[model samples]
Every structure is written in C-alpha cells, then in structure tokens.
Target: MATEDDGVHTICPYCGVGCGLKLKPGEEDGDVSLQPWFDAPVNEGALCIKGGASPQVVNHEDRLTEPLIGDGDGEFRTATWDEALTLIVDELERLAETYGPGATGFFASSKVMNEENYLLQKLARRYGTNNVDNCTRMCHASTVYTLRQSLGAGAMTNSMADLEEHGEVFWVQGANPAEQHVIAHSNYFREATRDGATLIQVDPHANKTTRDADIHLQLEPGTDIPLLNVVLKTIINEELYDETFIEERTTGFDHLEATLEGFDMEEAAERCGVPLADIQEAARIYAEADNAAIFTGMGMSQHTCGVDNVQNEVNLALLTGNLGRPGTGVNPLRGQNNVQGTCDVGAMPNVLPGYLEVDDDEARESVEEVWGFDIPPEPGLTNVEVSNAIGDAIHGLYVMGENPVMSEPDALEVENRLNDLEFLVVQDIFMTETAEFADVVLPATSWAERGGTVTNTDRRVQRMRKVTDVPGNTRHDLEILCEVGTRLFGDGFDFDGPEDVFEELRDVCPIYHGMTYESIGYEGIQWPCYEEGDEGDQYLYQETFDTDDGLGVIRGVRHQDPKEVPDDEFPLVLTTARLEEHYNTGTMSTRSPTLRRKTPENFVDIHPADAEKRGIEDEDYVTLRSRRGEIVLEAHVTEDIKEGVVWTTPHFSDARANTLTNDVLDPLAKIPEYKAAAAEVEPV
Candidate 1:
C-alpha cells in the first residue's frame, strides 16, 4: 500500500475542465483512488462524480490485456507485440503501395496527452498522408472554424477564472454545464451566479442548468440563429452596441447592419417559440452588463448550420465589444479533455501544429526542417469525409481511443463503412464497439498507467503522472506509435520519453514553445507562453485581435433549417444529451460500479404530452425509429422537455443513441447534425 509520500498529482482525464487530482495507491494492487488537490487553479479542490470515479476503471477486469489479431472469419487470437506490429506495418505498406498515401486515414485521440497526439499526427504526416482528424471534428470543428475566421484564433478567448473573477453577466446557450462540466459549474459558474451575476440560459429544455438560470429562453429546436439575430437587432435599435470599440477595433459593421434590416422581432419570437419580451430582456441583460461572456457547446455546433450559429455568436460578442478582455469573450466548452490540445498540436486535416496551414509552403518548410523530412503540401480529409470515402477512396484506417460506432451519427452507416475498410487497426484499453471490426486490436495503457500532459478548455497544459504499472502486456501510446513509425518509415521516430516528444512538439508548435513539465509545476501554465521566465497569457487578445489588421470581423448569418426536419412519418424531433454519471460512449465511466448503479441504462426522455399521445408511461419500453435506424429504450415521461421533442443520452451501449442521429454535414465544418433528427416513437 502507498503511503502519504507516494501520492502522485495529475489532471482529470474526463472533461475539458481538467480538474487537478491526486492519486494514492489503494489497498489492492493496481488500484488507486482520487484525492482532491486544493491548489489547482481550475477546480480548486472540487471534483465531479465522473472525475472522482475515474480511477475505478483503471484496473477493471474487462480491459484489453494483450494485442489481438483478427482472422478473416471474425475470430481474434492473442498475438505477440512483434506479430501485431509486423502485421500492421505490412498492411499499411501494402495499402499505401496499392492506392497511394491518400488512401489511408489516421484518427487520433483527444483523450491522450498533447505529446502523444503530436506524435500521432507526426507519424501520419511522415507516412505521406494528411488524412488525419480527431473527435473534435464532430464536437467543436464549427466553433474552431468560425472563431478562427472572425477572431483569428479557434480556442477559448478567456480563461475560466475570468468568468468567476470579472464576469457580471453570464450567457449560457446550447449547453448544460451543470451536468456536463460539474466541477466547473459547482466551483466557478455556480459561484458566479451566487455572486449576483445575471445568468441567462438559452436552450430547448428545462434541466438542472435552466433551473439555476435567472432567465430561461427555451426556444424551438434548430432556431438559435433567428433568436440570436433578433437580440442583435434589439441591441442595435436601442443603441446599446459599443460604437467606439467597433469603429476602432472591428470591421464589417455595414454588412452586419444590412443583414439585420429584415429581422422582425415578432417573427423571430414566433419562429423561435420565445416571447418577444423575454428576447428583449435577454438582449438588455447581455448588452448592459459591464462584463459578459457567452458559453456554447455541441448543442450549437452539431447542426447543419453549425458554423453560422457560431458566427452569429461571434458577431454578438464583437458588436458588444465583449472580446479581448477578461470575462468578456467567446468561450466554447470543449467536450473532450484534450480536444483543445489535440487541435493545437495539429491533428486536423488542414493545419500543422500551432494552426499553421498545411498548404502554406513556409509552414510546411518550418515543420519539415524540424523533422528532417518532406511534408504533405495538400490538405487532407476530415473525419466525416473519411467515413464517407471508405470503400472507394480510403482503404485503411488507424483509430486511437475513438468509438465511431457509438459516437458518430448514423451508426449503421459508420459500422458498414468501417467493415468495408481493407485494413483497420484500433488502439484502446477496452474492446469497444469499434474494436469489434478491427483487424488488429492493440492494447493501450489507461490514464492512470501513463504519464503525460493534457490541455484543458482554458488552454492550460497540466501534467498527468502515471499512478500504476501497465496491466499485463499493455503499452503506452507513445511507445506503440514510435515503434510503428520506426518500423514503417525507418528513422526520425526515436524518442527517449514523453518529454522528448514534447520537446520536439514545442520546436514545431510555437504556442507551446516555452512550456516544460517542470515549469508547469503544481499549477499548470496556459498556452501562448513564448520564452523562458515568461508566464502564459491567461486570456488571449488583450491588446489586439490575432487577425491581419488586429481587428475582429463581424459576419452576418442567417437561420437555416436542420437537414432533417419533422414530417408526416417522423413527427417528433430527437436530440441527444449527456449524463453526469457517464462519459462519452461509456468506455471508461460505465466500468465504475458506483456510476453504473447511479445510471445503469439509457432512456428516451419524452414530454408528458408526447408520451400521453403515444400511450407511453414512465419506465415503459418504447421503440424509437428514424430514417436511418431504430432502437428500444425505456420512456421517461417528463415535463422538462418541449412537447414535440425527445432527448436521450448516448452512454448506454445496449440502447445506442447515435443509431437515430442524422449524418448530414455542415458545408464548412463538415460536422454531422447530431442534435436534430426526425423520429417517431411507439410503445413496445
């Protein structure tokens, strides 16, 4: 058993909050428990249920203990590391030689550390393919795309501390932080609300978050743009916008003003299902506050018009001059723990590390010099695009810690496309739904068994120390990737440890240049730390925006209906939500006995009116069918949801919620419409 001196400090691997946790060895071997770290800046000694239970899954019996190679007949047998690596390298080589580098795609993990992600992307790029992406493609790709276009950066403009310290007003839209980011909500957001901040919540349901909101604008599903536009019109008409700030620090005012001409408040209220008075009051509360911030999530970015939704939010912030200051900026609460870091280190198809464009010759040359190799000049396919080009264009895939079958929209289509791949390799701790289709399943170390760093939503890079030895024959992600890269490309994959890979990453990613593990110390450092002895910037854009002219751009956006709308056959709209007790796909969280006892199964939440119409009662089994697929889940009759809408969480494997979600992609972001889908329900 570990003593007090044996405690190891690390960051939580669940959500983007990145709460600090201390692990002490439990009474049993390979078992550890989470202890609160009071000095952590983000959570300040607090942890959510998921974070507290994170250690429960580390030593679970179901963990993949060794590498498995699948035969042509759907049977998998244990294999040595040599056999598995050789098979992977040989298959990758065959695919590349047969169909060129572009035919292979690499899906990185957002759950791992920044160093691991950087190495994964480097390996993929060095192998001569830019078809690399991550789970962020489905979560916040729209937010990144829109924010970068308007403000010249794709990350959160302000720190979480800014909201608690300087925020006078909080506008939360399309997110339930109370359930999703429990520590952040309990420690910072709830504290802000208690401190007399005006909290305005805009969503389609009345849940735990809405209960705490000062004003709830429960609008119609997929009508965020109309309601937001009306608010912008109200602000402009009342002359509440920052005219001086706009004139001096922003551009495109005329174009934005022109787009608001035909936005009738009454029409918007009718379409959005919000009262005109409520809309006007929300606008005044946001515009009149001395300092206000807007927080959005997948609810705003998982639609056909996701980019437009984010662009409108950016315009709102720009018009009010709410950016470039503490407690006043566009903040997107990222879903995964290291999504911000994964993107920052260039796991996407378009950019190299530090948001450098892959197509740019100078950027390509900069990375090429550091790695001593030629890099790909062309931009690659996104996650959704790779799935769409499975059988014909793309043939092989290497997925790390992502369960596309349970997370991606149109589950049946994704499963079929994955099955059609010429060669598939999955590296994860558990035998997930996606792993069932893998030709080679490589066992990987869990968070407690690995030591590395993960960047949180606040852009804070914190270290996660290994608390236990790897179970059985499992290997760390860095070791596996370096070995595979060395075998495939023959050189430049040499690395002593995670810190060595991070040093190489710092050389390529300018944002993380001066940040070292030792420098991070107990309290982590936010990014944009350039030189030694320089502390990182807490909130970005203090003096000027990152744009070419140092001015923010305001883009006018219009409301667009979701790709799949309710019709005669499918009369209700289905949306997805998350459970506080469970994380995405239930890969790790479900293994916890405490979590499972709290939330054992998934259920479709239907309004009392809808449930009554279908003769369905609470706990009654029901069949929910969409054009794509169908599933059976228990019906939860509640008045919290709108009458025509239904909600469910995707954490349960037995009742997969993604089966009924839409796969229509946004033109710019390429994200699926996961929040809105046409469906119908019947009593089972």
Candidate 2:
C-alpha cells in the first residue's frame, strides 16, 4: 500500500522533535508518505522513523468509525452514539447512587487536545471527586514533581531553539533522544557536534544516542542518585562548585556539601557500575564547560525512586549554577504532545490549572469563584492507585484516549480489574485494547480531524487545524466530554468551543493571565503570559520562585534501589520503551500498514552474548518471564543492550511488555516502574 500525493505539511505526532512533515495523501486509495520540512523552527529538514511514517496513521483502516459496546458475552458489538452514551449515563448514575464520588475515576489521555484535557479535569473536579489522572503519571510525573518541589516550576527551562547556540557539553541520560526525538537530537548532536559541543551519554543500553557520544557511561539501573552524588562530591572535593552563583541564587550549599561528604568515588563506582575514572572525567568535563545542559527522558523517572533520580539531576544542575540562563538548565524531553499542557491545565489529581495545588485554600477558592461551585479540598489518588482500587472498590471509570490495558504495568491485573468493574466507559479514536473491555465506547476524532491547541514540549502552544473531516460518526473529544459532563453534572460546563474552554482556563489559572485565543493566534504563546508591558519570562525564577517564601527549597533525598532486582532465577533486567515506528499503546501507529510493516510485532532486544548463552538466535520466539507475568515474542539480538539486560517496546497487546513490568510505584510521583524489572528470557 502506497500513497496518492507527495505530501501535506503537518507536524510530527511522535516525540518532541515537532518536525515539519509533508504528508503524501493516498494516491491509489489507501497509502500515504511523509518527508522533511524545509522551514521548520526545530527540524529544518529531517524525519525520524516515527515521523517518516506518521502520515500512514491518518489513512489507517483499523481506525474505528463506529462506537462499540461490550455485550454480556465478553465481546464488543457495534452500537449507535446515542445508545452508547445512554447506557454509560445510566450505569454512571447507578454507580453514583450505590457508591460515592470516590467510586468513579477518570483517566484522561495525553495524546488529546489541551481543551479536551482541560474539560476532562474540570468535569472530574466539578463532579465532586479528585479521582483523575493522565499518562503524564507514567512518564514525567516524577520530573514534574521534583522540578516543582525544587525550582517552583514544572517545565523545561529552555526551549529547543537554545540547542542551536552552545559552547559546552550536552549531558544526555536515561533517554535515547537521537532515535526518539530525532530532529532535536540531529540538530543538537549531529549538527551541533560539528561546532564543538561534547556529547556525554549515560544509560544501560548502548542506544543510537550512545553510539556517537563523546563519552558513553553504561551505568547500572537505579544508580542515578549514587552516580550524581558521586559527581557532586567530586565537584565539591575539587572546588568545581560555582561559588558566586551558589552564594547569591541558592541557599542550601552548606547542608548539600555536608551530605555529599560520605559518598566517595569507590562506593559510587561499585553502586552505579561506572568506573571512578569515568565518573571523575564526566564531572570535570561538565564543570569546566561554558554552558552545559542536562537532557533527560523517562529512563530517569519511571522507577520506584523516580523522584529521587530527577531531584539528583536537578541538584547536579543547580549545584553547577545551571539555572535562569540560556542553554544551561534542566530540559526534560517530554514524552507526549501536550504533556506540558495537560499538566499546565490541571490533568493531575493533586494540582489545579497552572500547577496550583488542590489542597491550597487560595487556589481552591480561585477555581471555585470562576466555576461558581465549591471545589473539593482533598487531593486525589493517582492513575496507578485508581487501577489498583478498580476491583477493590472503584465501580466505574471513564477513560479518554488512553489504552491502559496495553500500557499499564501488571496489565493482566489491569484487565481483570476492568472486567470486574461495574461499568467502564472508553472514549478513543479506535477500539483500543482497553476499549475492548469497555461497557461503552465513544468514537472520537484524531488530531487531523480536530481543531484545537496543543502545548509542545517547550510550553509553546500550537494551533492544530481540522485538516480532515471526522472519519465517520466520530465526534471531537471536547464535544463528547461536554455532552457527558452536562448529562452527569448540571450547568458547570457551558463552553461553546476550544476557545471558550481556553478563556475559562486562563481566567482561573493565574499563570495564564492576559492570555487569550487571539493573543495565542497562529504561533503559540508560552504561559506566564501576561498583558503588554508585563513581559512573560521564558526561564523562571529570575527574580524569585513561586513558593510561600518566594524561594526554591532543596528537599533532602536518599538513594533507594528499585523494588525489583535481578536475582539468580530472574537474572536479566528487562525494560520497556517506545520505538520510532510506534507510539504508546499503538492504537494509531500500529493501525497503519506502512508503520505496521516497518515493525510488525514486538520483539525482545537482547544482547548477542546473552542470546548465544541461552541458545537463542535472532528472530527466535522467546519467553520473557517476570515475577508479575510472562510474554512470548521474537528475539532481536544486538549489542544495543547490556549482557544481562533486555528491552522491549510496549506498543502491542498481542505481546504486551507491561504484563511483565513490576507494579511498584515511586512513593512521591506514584508512577510505576516501567523501565526496570527482573525477568528471565528463554527460547519459547
């Protein structure tokens, strides 16, 4: 299957590369192609494997056109929109009557629009419960939590444009952005490396990003804190600390210096599986650099100690005075299109719009005034907690866009919980694996068929036009959300369109003051957007932070190991990640034949030696068993992974990698351990 036209100008739907793509419309009927954007701000002319085949998804046949309802016989049946909505409303009312608001939870999707995500959170809060969460919880919730705690801001400090001008080192850890955020990495690494910026990669896997690195430290998993601590100790011992910046901008040098005293190179070397020489070299190079930057992905923040891992990174940056400057701050390469926006608009259970806490009386009062309703004061359970509580107590769940059955850890348990639920309503563009268990499925429009705004990784809100019509009877997600909200609660939600929602959001969310649909026209406006003559700061904390004392506080952190460790029986550490061809859960990417053909099924990415020792060969069907469960897939033996570690992408339900992931979550972020788990791999 090939495409009809050469391409249409569009944005990449995969990573934060946000590459400009030329989408080739189907020529013969059901094919599409994509090419590089010659004039993109980020990617001038390039595409990753994900972006290269992004156009194929819009023309995918498996995209759902009709609503689906799970009949009593463990099978889904096509149903009209009205019928499905009616059934869901009836069941929701029943659940509301039987159990209180706590029994009902809502899980919004990151892959949707900012307006829809905002509305979903509004519905949850207005409905008198905080049982709301999103995909951010699984990815960068730890990064967000740690940044908010330490810096009083929960976003990337510098824009990707900062990667253009650099004179220092680029320290990339916990992510393979070269393959993931292809365009950004190409510019920063491939293009900028020629200009003299040293690249340092830190990860267990010898990924694409590591291959071309000036220095690649293959550290052990869950050793982020120890390694960072060792670096900090080296910097302190060798007088590499930024004295002036620490004296003026920061407040916790004495305590931090004292804390780093006990952590030596020998202890850290053994703990982190990095040589003392390499640790010292990395530290010296970073300290000596004119403008060093730290870029992190989910690898650093998807563990039981996820918050600590990120805090350590931030601590490292702040110690070296890498704040409130250009090309010198913590830059989190966000996992999804509006992960930053969703958090900005209050998708998390604990926070309101503009990262305001629900427990804060002032913030609660502000939202209450705008909505004209008394909002709840208590914080809510996270996504993982809601999943664990599904069968235990929760009666109904309204899932929008996300396919948790294929993505959540201990997925078999998640399926059982969904099966046990009194009612499960899923709203998505396709009949996803999670939707297969839904009592009612609402067909929603995709990115191409919807008109709204999405916040990019840099907090730059971009306009997404309705380039294509709704595939069938599928409606915009916001409309469905409003309809369901009106049916459930009364007159709280009365928005006409995405703009109306944005106006309301800006009114209540203080950081968005003076921001309007008109102001944010065509080119997006970053938040902290104020009126003319009231400049909006790009990097925060220039004058002071948003804390009670107007100063950022350094929360003490302790190094903790992962809950699941490699043992004799389960000798290999198995981690799950996304591929360039497929996104999370693969509800859209996998539907595309071209994308599907690139990587048809899930496979175990094992080291060559490990495969040989186990009598396994490339493309051999192998069974990877963890304490939670087991999954059989084809083995992809390569040197990309370490000897005792294996990797798999969690995009396929036929071979879900999450089924074998440990459900242990970070105590602070409540995010599950998707990166590291103990598993045994053998030929199936």
Give me the candidate number with maximum lDDT: 1
Summing lDDT over every window of 10 consecutive residues in candidate 1, give the lowest-scoring window.
1-10
Compared with the true structure, what per-residue lDDT tens digits does model 1 show for residues 1-684? 212374888888899999988898777657997787777778877988888888888899999999999985578999999999999999999998999989999999899888888988998899898999999998999999998888888999998898888998889989999999888788888899999988899999888898779999998889999999999999999999999889998999888889988778899899999999999999999999889999999899999899999988998999999988888899999888999999999999999999999999998999999999888899999998998899999999999989998889999999989979999999999999999999999999999988888999989988888888889999999999999999998898889999899888889998888988788877788988887666898788878898889989997888899988999999999999888899988999888999999989889889999999889999999999999989999999998899899999989888999999988999999999999999999999
In the order shown, the candidates' Cα RMSDs to the true structure are 1.6, 3.2
Q: Give me candidate 1's TM-score against the actual structure.
A: 0.99
- In order, candidate lDDTs are 0.90, 0.79
lDDT of 2 by residue, 237-316 (tens): 98897887776666667777667756566977887788988988999999888788888889999999999888878877
Residue 619, candidate 1: Cα error in Å is 1.5
